[model samples]
Target: MSAAITDGAVKALISQLGYSSLYPPQEMAVKSGILEYERILVTTPTASGKTLIAMMAILKAVEKGMKAVYLTPLRALASEKYDDLKILEKLDLGGSKIRVTVATTDYDSSGNELAGADVIVLTNEKMDTLFRHNAEWLGNVGIFVSDEVHLIGDRERGPTLEMMLTKIRRNYPQSQVVALSATVANSDEIADWLGCKLVESDWRPTKLVEGVYEYGAVKMSDGSKFKVESSGVSSAVDLAIDSFNGGGQALIFAETRKRAASLAAKAVDGVYKRLDKAARELAAGASADILARGDDSELTKTLAQLVAKGVAFHHKGIIKILTATPTLAAGVNLPARRVVIASILRYDSDYGGSVPISVLEYKQLCGRAGRPKYDAFGEAVIVSERGVNAEELYDHYVLGSPEPLRSQLSNDSAIRFHLLSAIATMPGMKKPEIHDLFAGTLFARQYRSATV
Candidate 1:
């Protein structure tokens, strides 16, 4: 009900950004005292102003003459946050200017340089490495903003985030933590672990419609079926073509990099046929620019040709185009009118089998459907046939919530690495104290309960 922000510069910036009113999630976050140095975990839908909440807290920290650090899981995301936050550097913070720095890349920054920074953005690994090197400036940090906190569920990078958070919580007990997360099913558990209040919501700025595509028709989650004119073509191509014809961009998530490229190449004919002359020229120029970067390989050319036709596939392999890997989903800003999940199962060599991705992961993919300001509604389509069924996908992905956050600290290698780093960084930290630090981790909490 009340304006949670009281700082003059922050209020002016928010007004300049044209936020006359806060959305439900942002309002809850503010009312929860996130702006008052309370450790808070915000789990909400994308584009719901989580970044704004973090910024308000960061500004609050800077106003108190203390430094803040924004930690992201990916370098690209750190760069994106840096670009957005670097503008604050120009603001006269009551006669003194804020100095924002991005430390995502592998660079050696001295302690004095870091101490002079008002705000610093760094990736999880970069921050962990900084800790290993004992960045003395960390002692003066008053707040830490962690973006994409749900990545704690990831096996590879999850441990890094957990370790970093644990280290920050244990070592920097006086510093406040503002964690930003996607809407996960077990947000309360994560909140409990961090001793922060959970401000969760499913709010979205645009309406999202979920459906399953089969036989040239989409069976929406609401039980409404709409026939897509295939004109003898397959249903998948028809769905994509229809979206483009409706003047909206489409993003397709395939099972593999090869499938993504092949599907993009296949859709080119349909996409090109529907585009007008002006649109075609613009797509061609985009495609030419991609090719000019010059890999000349079949895959690159294949993707370039698709981009030329206003149809493109995204994955880790293809660069310069939109990507939707979990890492990219958090960082990349590409918005599509429709998102088609070509396959739910991705082959994981570690498991030596095809594994279905979690509903949370798929939900993140679906969240990409509508651009905030451009589209009235976004469509998320799941391609169903053969091995994967339509009804099952609808029940699992559409109806199901995200998976709970599980700690990755159980991995011996991860614990060993972090233990060594903690010991090396903390002066004269004894064995029993180190054990206490690990005992306070989410993994310890989960394991202790699982045994009970």
Candidate 2:
């Protein structure tokens, strides 16, 4: 059982919650001395107990009377982790209660408020804003856990995480940073940046079967093929129907909001036929709730109707529902027995045309397929369309490795903002200090020839 390997009090708490064994990656993480000051970068698949590694380190930090911070990429994920960590309040840390608090979009926490809590959860941006404002609580933390650490490669938001990490390592050098990330190709590079031990694994609790759907048949990566009863429907719709007929829920990811809604509406009839009376009533209630939001648009109505039949779609523009989207794939925990990639391309306004999504993004969507303990094996199928061939999709997505995590810290705008914030927040901070700080970033490590 995990209790024999985990900390005593932490073991008791986790055992009380029915968690007794450790996953392979989690066991490697705990054995790597993460709870004893060794920094660690965990790059593994989704639902692989990455968070448990963080929890073990956090409990260790709290046991030692040190504060810990849990940083997430999204507010929703922050809340989810906060709720999960709330159980730590019952952990008898030598008779002291562990104060767990969340600072997200809801309210900004003052230095004193954050300092008082044993564990503080925040979105990366929110945590960065707090640091910019010179929150005193940021300095006292001894453990900093970053979930979805692979986002450091994202251009728009990756810079903030990169800069925040640089600042954290510069300012709070003593803190133990446990970075949890999706499996990336260049995990060693990230570990080098954090100066941490690397733990990478392809182990998953549930088997994952990835493939491509074309001409009403799914060609699996393992060389197996299954005929789908799509009967004139797109491969995406056919896959969903096959999953439902097999008594499993399907999560379909579409590129556009309109396409997502249409697919959901199209899949509803197929999904409804397999639903029993109880499921039908539950789906109907959920659908009514979606419609009650009072958006009389046809898309909303279609979305609601689909939900009534036990199928739903998700996109940023549509109302938040239990469904599929790139955003959902990244931040939320809505799993399905099968995951369908409706499109591999999205309209990029910056490029003025549709562009193929990165391998990392597609992998995240595929990660949404297996629900641990519930599904024996999960299926992730990519639907091929015009201009995109089935063989190409299989090679590019089903068997491709995720892109490496590159720091976005060198952008002129990011440097300008962070430098200004550093000078303003740190008392008597000199130009030399700024130079030294930026020089220590992953950007500096990657581009040794360039001057920060």
**Which candidate number has the best lDDT?**
2
Name the 10 consecutive residues with the lowest summed lDDT in model 2: 315-324
What lDDT score is found at residue 434 in candidate 2?
75
How well does model 2 score by local distance difference test? 0.80
1-452 in candidate 2: lDDT tens per residue? 75336468767766766776778998888778876878999998888888778988998888887889999998878888999899888778677899999988633444456677989999988888788677776667889998988888887788888888988888888999999877677888889889899998999888899998877778997789998886475678777777777767678888877677677667666667777888888888887888887589987787777777777776222111234557777656777889888888888876999899999988888888877888998889888887778898888888888887777866788778877877877879887887788888888888772567
Clashing pairs in 2: 2-20
Please, what are the lDDT tens digits per residue for candidate 1 over residues 339-384? 7777778778789998998987888888778878888888889888
Local distance difference test values of all predictions, in order: 0.79, 0.80
Backbone Cα, N, C clashes tallied per candidate: 0, 1
Model 2 spans with C-alpha error above 4 angstroms: 2-6, 106-112, 231-233, 288-305, 315-322
**By how many angstroms RMSD does model 2 differ from the true structure?**
3.1
TM-score of every candidate: 0.90, 0.91
Leading candidate by TM-score: 2
